[model samples]
Target: MCKAVFFKKLKYRRDVLGDVIVNKHKCLYCGTCVAVCPMDAIELIDKWVEINEDCNDCSVCAKICPVGALGGVK
Candidate 1:
């Protein structure tokens, strides 16, 4: 039998800024960010995707974004 490797729960800093930043004007109503986010923080609303409470600020979504819609503030 194979034993599963248990991992500790991920604890992220609340004040940390995510690397993804959405440009409202440049956005094309694509769901790329929503699909790429591991934490499921982004959601599509009225054809536009928006970040929700589930955001862990990991920046995975930003890195995968093809159009550079999501990026860090700094």
Candidate 2:
């Protein structure tokens, strides 16, 4: 059986300014961020959540993360 690992295939990409940062460890793969993203920037691929470049750093995804796994780092 294959288990999901943190940061697997997910690149450490952040916006130039204060953008959304995903804490892989804290993420529950609940898809909350993906559903709440107004720009449709966050995606759940396999088991990893990917934030695409279309992200506008509005912090909507970060705000919706239930586990506090997403945030903005400035």
Candidate 3:
């Protein structure tokens, strides 16, 4: 209960701190982001890149993305 509440309250920080945002329409689905992510936070599912909480705003994926679809909010 307490932990849940804490997580819920801090959930927004997940994005501000380091969460990676993927723009599906612009994604090339070339698997570059997945391969370049140092934290393995980016995953190529079906035809899109998915960003998990494992990201640390390293920007590796963003820099490596050929289509400029990945962004980290550090």
Candidate 4:
């Protein structure tokens, strides 16, 4: 029972920390942001890297993007 409780808490933490968003219109299709994201939450689709629900909003992708294509929620 104790093990089950610990797993449940861990799952909750993971879910809460995962929040990321990307603007498709601003995306440059350079793939630089995708490559820099540590969480692997960004993916290229139709020349834009879409941010998934798993994104942690670390801003790494945005910082690395040369063209300022990626940005997190303000």
Quote each prediction's TM-score: 0.63, 0.73, 0.71, 0.61
CA deviation > 4 Å runs, candidate 4:
1-21
Model number with the top TM-score? 2
lDDT of every predicted structure (CA atoms):
0.66, 0.77, 0.78, 0.69
Q: Which tens-of-lDDT digit does each residue in 1-74 have in candidate 1?
A: 23332221112222234434577776776787788778888888996777766776777777777777776534
The TM-score obtained by model 2 is 0.73
Clashes per candidate, residues 3 or more apart or on different chains: 4, 0, 0, 0
Which digits, one per residue and each the tens of the lDDT, describe model 3 over residues 3-73? 98988767656766667777778888999878877888777788766777787788888888888987756
Expressed as tens digits, the lDDT of each residue in 1-74 for candidate 2 is: 23344343233433435667778899999998888888998999998888877888888777778789988656
Worst 10 residues of 1 by lDDT: 6-15
Model 3 scores a TM of 0.71
Best by lDDT: 3
Residue pairs with clashing backbones, model 3: none
Candidate order by decreasing TM-score: 2, 3, 1, 4
Q: Give the per-residue lDDT of model 4 (tens digit) for 39-68.
A: 888888876566765777778887787767
- For model 2, the local distance difference test gives 0.77
Query: How many clashes show up in model 2?
Result: 0
Model 1 lDDT at residue 37:
79
